[model samples]
Target chain A: MSGVLTISQPGNSVVTDLGRFRGPRYGLPVNGALDQFSARAANILAGNEDNDPLIEITALDFRLRTDTDILVAVTGAPVTLSVGGRTCPQWEPVSVRAGETLAVRGMTGGLRAYLAVHGSVAAPVLLGSCAPDTVVGFGLKLAEGTQLEVRRSVAPIRQPYFDLPLFRLGLSRPEFGTELVVDVTDGPDIDEFGDSAGLLFSSSFTVSGRSNHIGLRLGGELPERQSSAELLSRGVPVGAVEVPSRDELLVLHRGRGVTAGYPVLAVVTSMSLDILAQARPGHTVTFRRTTVAEAAGALRTATRQLENLRAAVTTVFGLLGIGAQPQWHDLAPAVGS
Target chain B: MPVNAAAIEVHESGDSALRVVAVDADREANWTTVHRLAEWLESSGADGVYGAVPTYDSVLVEFDARSTSARQVKAFVQLGLRQLGHADTQVRAPREFDVPVVYGGEYGPDLERVAGQQGLSTEDVVRLHCAGSYVIRCLGAPAGSPMMDGPGFPLPVPRLKDPRLSVPAGAVAVAGRQAVIAPATAPGGWCVIGQTPLTLLNLANEPLVPYMPGDRLSFIPVPAADFGGYAGRYLEPAR
Candidate 1:
């Protein structure tokens, strides 16, 4: 029920989970998957729970050798998957034989990729999650010679060629590019900037090098606030677009601190968070204003689509008599039990 | 009488969260309202309420958009405020702590500079710093890093124009009318005054953060040798 994965080549990657949602209560950031949709899709394809621990491969050259047979799915940033020199399809469940090396390389169109195995990757869970928060020194980073313990014995699920369409349909394939139009809702401090708030939507910004899970610092026209009054520190949620000292625009991300002193002019919509996650350092972005109702509607639609995908995938697995582990059973229970 | 709906402004932060801000100009009143609202939210066990983080003047209530809307969360906060009334809620007797520190040495490189700026001796600066009973306004920047507001110095101790690349953990620093202990080594603009040996955050403990908002803190100068022993004795097992 346990297998060891030895890291032969660990690209810039970290072990991540759904992230610690309750982290803010302790003044800690919610450290989790940057692209949650892709992470969950990988988990569903791997027949594991959506919240199960997975590897977030940031750099392209990630390689690992499994000591035992295991089922795994690689999603997010389009990457070439290979096992012992044999090319394998991304976003589909692939069984790696014992002593075989799985290589993920030539990443394109995105900044991160997710690798989810059956059952879950066993790691030390601090504060209810295994996602790495480098700021707090929590969780582990994949490196060469690192050993990853994955629990659960996976049985290979065979599928006919006709089932490929259904499997492909269930997989999440996000278009990655340099220019992105991110949707945002009015922030708590939107009025602080007065007329300058309009500039946020009109101006284009380039993602600066100072970008990480904590925030995506944008280099663009500085938006000035009307008043120079000292504002009190307040809770800053994920996707907060904060303008600190009229220097640069910073969009807080999953690993953002609980509170920030700067005024937030807008918050990125939940639907566009996945697109923002794929933005690279040189990526250009423009904020598109959206109503809260519209943003919420879009999020609901995205969520419903994911639910439908999960149901379709579950049905396909059931028809094939594949006893795939129920990851997100809220959509549909595993039928072939 | 209706909790002065005008006194509290509920603003939407994104589609899923609402930022409840007390419009009181008085800092203490604002914090008091936020703290009480946070307590009510925590105790009410409201469904779809993820959690509420109390800041200096506001509380951000995060909710599950799939289950609840921002408007619903605002109504919940308003209802909680109405039940509590306009008068400030009874402030609980804050838990007091005697934090031991070693000042004016390698631990506090800027101690001499701070004392010089205030036209006081290093000993006088330490005395003035330890004299006041500081209240923990909030825990921020990092986990368990308490931002305590205390008595103002003889002269305003402005933050470093150029922040240090890193300040060691447990380093006591002051900026404006506030003093804070570094929870972990981080780049900060606060002027370093001293260093404390006390552990503010320990994951091994049941309650990760040793102190919370509204706690009272006082510093006691101890020799470097006595720090280790004093910390071991003062450090309480997380509840």
Candidate 2:
């Protein structure tokens, strides 16, 4: 099958072969399918491990092509999807016949969308990850004329529906005009913002357009600082909320500089990574200080739920006499019927 | 009235993560101690420590909190600080890296301005910069950028009032008392003097970034004409 996927924002979109470079050195930061859990869920529905590389579409406009029949599923953001010009339901595995093109247009639920092929798209592996970081020019972004190798062998299965947890599908119901509550863990600079900063700790913040893969530039009341001395450069982590000014909040992302000189007020917890990934620019983001114990508990619960989903998938396919083993070959194309 | 001691000083950022505060304000001693502690944790392989990150004056130790206790991790950090008190800072030599740069012209659009701001000739600026052996204070900026310390000239130049939307890769910038090399093209505010040919930050690499906080840097100047030659050299391995 032959298809074409074009990006409205060439600077905004990319089509990368799986795993081109080793780590995050592909010019841009690794900005793939933001909702990784849902990306994995799409794979599981196709009888694959959640790790397979899928089409991570930003603002949709992704198209799939194949000469033969294929099975596919859409996860993450809900989009107006069609296969050979026929409408279909989302989050369900749909199979298509040969020479059919599947197209996904503009987002309806979230900012990003993902399309998983029956057999995983063939891309080179770098540092054991197929995800592409266009910033550093590591992995490839999906683009027109980007020829990907797909396994020709088709083992078609007629599965009715996928029984995955709604949360696992990463369906986000974004509340526009409201501050997004992100859980935070205090940082070394937490105490630097004096008693008034404590007021900040208790207050909320709004995500500004300045937010990007590097970090979120937050606009809010500055946390009080006990000392005004400049800081030395140090490392930062994903989801870190660092206030460099009296009224500025910078929330770090995955590509946050290894080190920073700004005093971090708090860090966004991992439990909220999927949620943070779904956040659009200019969205209001607020912080609620959670107890360490509560944070740990939430992480454990998320991990457990992830494992349970994997187990459920295994059981369902196992009973059907299918190997059900996690394989790249099980994923279908993004444009599914 | 008895003031209840500051609440055990614990906060949450993420569900699976926790950050321990060593110092709240900017204290040179505190920052150094934090770095020393970070170095210790990285080498010790303490339980639950995913990575120890140091910023201006504090260090952030990230852990799988689920696999390890925050209290235990804090205790480990305390122990590392105590150990730093006795460790010889001079025993281990710093990592040395040589970064080549293409000075002036398009590669360094702001070089003339930077030199003029320093009240020196373009050649004098390069000479002053290359004359000294610099030490890496940190890898600030974006994930792979390096912040180094070199000899201060006549005066400490201020940062760009408004940061550039996109600073080219290998950018050699100066602000206040520090000189830094931008590994990748990201927005920056420092006064640009030249552009380096080194790709300091590559997430694809094993260590993600090649330079470290305690590393030493030597800047080698290359003519603008030779920029293409050097750029080609670095691209060889990338391809």
Candidate 3:
């Protein structure tokens, strides 16, 4: 049941799952796939559950050799994917023969890409997930010569051409235009900045090189706190836009610590988190104020799309006379939901 | 009487989370109420409640927005507050620990600077620091890192303007009026006064963290030569 996928060239990749959702209670960050939509899409295409462990490659140069025939899919930023010298398409399932070398090279758009394989990638699960959290010293950062043990699933599905409509609609790529506009809702400490809270939406910030999974550090005009009193440390959710003492803003991400002391001006909407995840160093970003109702609506729509994807996958499996994995239906709602 | 619903300010953290903040003036009372509320919410068989995190002055309740709304979470919290009316919440007794520490020298490089800032001799600084009983305010920053609050020094020591690249685990440090022992080697600004031999966060142990919020902590100064024995003894499982 177990097969090995040897990393011929790891590039900048890490093993990540949907994230460790329940770890925050124990003061652990909910580290997961930064571009969750792309991760899920890859999982769906590979005939795996949405939360199955996958490879998150940043600045793609990943190469792997499979020890057994494996169903695989690549999603997220547009990249050149090749298997045994034959160019393969992104955002669709592809089968690779045993000992075939699959290479993903030169991502053109988004900063990160997801490579999901059929069946579970057997990794040590800390807390409840296999997501690599570098901050917590958990999980692995795949490198050249790394061997990933995978439990091969025996599904009967064999479709030559299966394309999801959502993939054609540019749903996989992050919105990385000249200016990335992210939607945010007012945070608990919004009023602490007084009238300057409006500055959060108005100011344009450049993502600093210091940015990582922990947070996206932005260099720009920071909103000044009207009150001189210090804020008590409290639980901060992922996507919290925290303004510290320095002239920089930090948008906490999936790998953020459990608690933070800086005043959080706004929280990025769940739907817009994927956009932030793809923001590379030097990208200019601006926030747009949105209401909770609108944010919730956006999240609901995204969840429904994933649900549709799940159904579509089930249909494809059924049409091909393959049994749909029951675990695929257990896809949890995206962050905050 | 139960704290009035109006007394607590509910702020929407995001679409799916709400932060219920206690009035800032009464630190102890506010923290107590928040802790009790958090305990109640965790114990309650309420649908859609993801989890509640209690801090010094607030409880952030994260709910499943797919099934529950922010408004509904606030209402549930208000109901819990009402139910707590007039009843003194029986909190678990604070667990007291005598942490053996080796002060000054290699374990704590900032001890001399801390002593100088306090206008006291190095011996006197360690004596005063170990004298006060500290209370764990929260476990945060890093997993199982206890943030404890206690009596302040004669002159409060400020956090390092330039934080250290890496502070070793078990390095007991002070910043503002709070004290913390690093759970893992991490970059921090706190002034390190001593290092404890006890493992603060051993995942292999039955209880991962040695202390939780509301626990009492007191430092015991020990000779550096005896540090190894204490470290080994603390790591031993109870027979």
Which of the numbered candidates is closest to the native, going by highest lDDT?
A: 1
Writing each residue's lDDT as its tens digit, candidate 1 over A1-337 gives: 2367889999898889978877777788877999988898889887667889999999568999987777788988888999878788888778787788999999878899999987667778877888887666778888899887766645544455754522564544677888999999998888988988898988899998888888899989867788878777889888899887556788988888888788889999876888888998888999899988898888777677767767876776676544544632121222221
Summarize candidate 3's per-residue lDDT along B37-119 as a digit string, tens digits: 88788788479886777889988787767677888888899888887655666778788878888998999889999888888
Model-by-model lDDT, in order? 0.80, 0.61, 0.79
Which has the better DockQ: candidate 1, or candidate 2?
1
Docking class of 3: medium
Per-model root-mean-square deviation over C-alphas: 4.4, 6.7, 4.8
Q: Which tens-of-lDDT digit does each residue in A293-323 have in candidate 2?
A: 7777776766566566667655655665344
Model 3 local distance difference test score: 0.79
DockQ list for all candidates: 0.69, 0.32, 0.61
Between candidates 2 and 3, the one scoring higher on lDDT is: 3
Better of 2 and 3 by DockQ: 3
Per-residue C-alpha lDDT of model 3 across residues A219-250, encoded as one tens digit per residue: 98888888878678898888899887666898
Against the true structure, candidate 2 reaches a TM-score of: 0.77
Candidate No. with top DockQ: 1
Chain B alone, candidate 3, TM-score of 0.90
Off by over 4 Å in 3: A154-174, A324-337, B1-6, B86-89, B205-207, B230-239
